[model samples]
Target: MNVSTASARVPEGWREVNRAMWDERVPVHVAGSFYDLDGFRTRRDDLRDFEKAEVGDVTGKSLLHLQCHIGTDTLSWIHHGAARVVGLDFSAPAVEAARALAADLGHGPERAAFVTGDVYDAAETVPEPSYDIVYTGLGALCWLPDIRRWAETAASLVKPGGFLYLAEFHPFTEALDDATGTRIVRDYFSRGAQVWDEPGTYADQDAVTVNNRSVEWQHTLGDVVSALAAAGLRIEFLHEHDVSLFPRFDNFEVRDGYHRFPEDHPRIPLIYSLKAAKS
Candidate 1:
């Protein structure tokens, strides 16, 4: 929002514009069935199996989640045996919700904590200098414009022998047609701030809302991997999955606790996960 795009002059900063939209949607997301807050409180974890397998065990280890929206996934880490967990988000309302959820789950500050800050400032915003695991969940990277800055910030937060894990919607999906998602209509390597104005959040698209405009950027997998490797982290592995946690396309159907193209449709990588260790 800072830079003047050809289309519009958004005087508001990206953080301000995006955070406003997220802040307005925090309550809607929590109450909506998408998050399943009640089921989560009852000890049901929504973390995908692939994420658990790649991150391995967290027993007694410290973890930091950057851009950690409402901290649903952050609290889930504490339940999975993390010694302590810290969640950082740009939205004050999201952080408040996370703190309330932590309290509801009977976790004190030592065990569960949340901070309100920008992801680019994570190195200084987090409670500790470093953590055993620096995790970023799905849909996080697209919000960031500078991939290298984000990589450096996240890498700086990983302790020696620790790793930074990221699970995100594949940038490839962005290049496809929005409706059918089969034709490549957009530039694959385009790296610029994209402005979007939609009426509702992904959770409940039908629900009316204010603060509907948001700005985002696209960072390709190659760009992300190269940036992290340049930041002094050893790339462990990059795994692309055909499964999507949500209905990303009209043809997508639920299968094995995930959504994917139906039997008749060809599969494409809908998401990807990567692990880079700070050795």
Candidate 2:
């Protein structure tokens, strides 16, 4: 389905549908072990090696994390040396949970802040003057129907000389089937939104049984790069990785907190990250 079809289904439409779905998932995620709340309570870091090396030192920098669900990675930046961090999301429950989690973790407002707002409306909802770094977490880009608008919003939030960093599921990975994950089951260049009506989530497959319906769009690497360029950001580097942070496919084996395909399997890029500076 497309945005037009999604818009016709209900009042306030696709965004509303996604928001409600996430609101329902927040409680499950907080209590689930997948996010490892128990682990985060003792450890201030939640970021992986790739992010640390690519983004470099955030020490004393003001960072903005867009689509920061539950603030795990956002708070991780603080542990890495960011002076201040602002996390924004569309889900109110997620924002509330993130604030409570931060407080419980001894993070006061001085170190971290959480805002509930759509990424598309971030410019108005968030503070002005931009930030030293704008970070977008994984699995974030597919939720939105418009990448151009998303890129513009991201660029608008970055100060000149500052950069926007993104780590996302590759469009090639999205084309593979969700079960076996070996065969390509969807179109890689699809522009319209694909409707999903699955129960539970990637975090936990058997936690709940609600009909979690949502809409997702596929965005190509060209789409991402062009959008950033059109928004006046200079591309620095784009890298694709063979390993994924989560188990996206059945063939992946969990090791060292990342999922990897068997050595014999065909090598394909499952994740990608890019850094773009506002020049």
Candidate 3:
């Protein structure tokens, strides 16, 4: 789907801005050493250990992956035996890349589908209460402005007994400034607006451009759980981990596909995964 026009509906011009950013970041991410496409193709569990442990046994289940950038993890679910997988993202370029990858792997529309659309508009475009699992991965929640709307959409997509799974960066970690390698710059509990000047992306370090203005919102851990619960989903499990899927902090060490802060680093949670089921 061509999402160029849909980008106009995004509040605060974020749709267009994020589209451009993801478009530019696609090739960089595909070529980046961090992704390791070849390795991923050979191994099904290329994702974080927490993901493997939390999102267990998806065999023959229908899954909807929201904010599925380039559809890497979404495809991984297919490899793990998901009967059908639908990947939704706002970036046309990322969706194109994902389609190409799926084709390369011999997966057709019968087994997997990719759509380019805003998360808020996804339910309008696709069937709701049709999926057994609604999944979103790390770094996805920050891009969205409202958790309440997200939870509503998530609940709508899941079947009566279906579950929603999310593995995201912890709100506490978002308060720290890892760029300067110095000190805590933002308030941990502050539910304030954050304006970012960004020519590049978190995955790419070499990218530099003129359009470098975007806004993001921070939600505390309490905010995330409460929003989902209020949306009529029952919390099944909530797990916090000290390690992350990527190097979130400058002083972190990468060991065995996980990133951890220094030995004496504060015990603040770095990543968290949650599972909620619709009653």
Candidate 4:
């Protein structure tokens, strides 16, 4: 929010464009009810039930979170019993907010740290060369232009025997129409950049904002698995779920703790998670 904007994307590229947008949204997200900062302060941060179960225990293990937007989830790892955690993001504002929130939670730099760096440069940017666990999730891969490069970078950060865990929105949704989510509207396997010229942040669709244009890429579930495999990480498991934490379509209804299509509607892979380990 404190960050200024209005730079043209043509001169800077997708990273700059995306960074500017997120930098601008830091204030909005911090204050908005979407993040529920107040509630997080009162409760111990836990990942989604499935995520927590899949990731197993974090007790005393050093963990690194890639694309850790504002460190809310980063700090949660500590609360979940990780001995130490480091959160990395390209947006300085997001890292700043994360650090501020970490301090408020009584987590000093020694226990919880946040760094400003591009995801591609994470292997060299973070203080530690590798970690016991490298975690990436919650809509991270779409921001990347090269899934192979991203996988290589993420794989390089995981210590031998440690694993990289990712839980992401299924890329299949990108192919479906937004309204009913049943019609095909875009190429499911296209590698071209998808430019979205829209206003407001996802947290507040109606919010007045300046950095509106964003460019994102789509990587199919196959693309992700293959990339990690090429990066020297052995495939552990790939699991798909029919529910999402956020409402992704008009017909999606909230059930239990996640959003799902109606009972009569055929289930689709709304979200997917995987664990690939360094042997």
For every candidate in turn, the CA RMSD to the true structure comes to 2.8, 2.9, 5.0, 4.0
List ranges where model 4 is wrong by over 4 Å. Answer: 1-12
Better candidate by lDDT, 3 or 4: 4
lDDT by residue for model 2 (1-279), tens: 112222323234778888888999999899998888889888877887998999998999999999999999999998888998999999999999899999998889878899999999999887655999999989999898889999999999999999999999888987787766788877777677667777787788776756477877778999999999999999999999988977777778876778988778787898899999987
The residue ranges of model 3 lying beyond 4 angstroms of the native Cα positions read 1-11, 127-129, 177-184
Write down the lDDT of every candidate, Cα atoms only.
Answer: 0.88, 0.87, 0.79, 0.87
TM agreement with the true structure for every prediction? 0.95, 0.93, 0.89, 0.94
Better of 1 and 2 by TM-score: 1
TM-score of model number 2: 0.93
Looking at candidate 4, the ten consecutive residues that score lowest on lDDT are: 1-10
Cα lDDT for residue 139, candidate 1: 89
lDDT of 1 by residue, 51-119 (tens): 999999999999999999988899888888999999999999999999998999899988998999999
Better of 3 and 4 by TM-score: 4
**Which 10-residue span in candidate 2 carries the lowest summed lDDT?**
1-10
TM-score leaderboard ranking: 1, 4, 2, 3
Ranking of predictions according to lDDT: 1, 4, 2, 3
- Tell me the RMSD of model 4 versus the true structure: 4.0
Model 1 RMSD vs true structure: 2.8
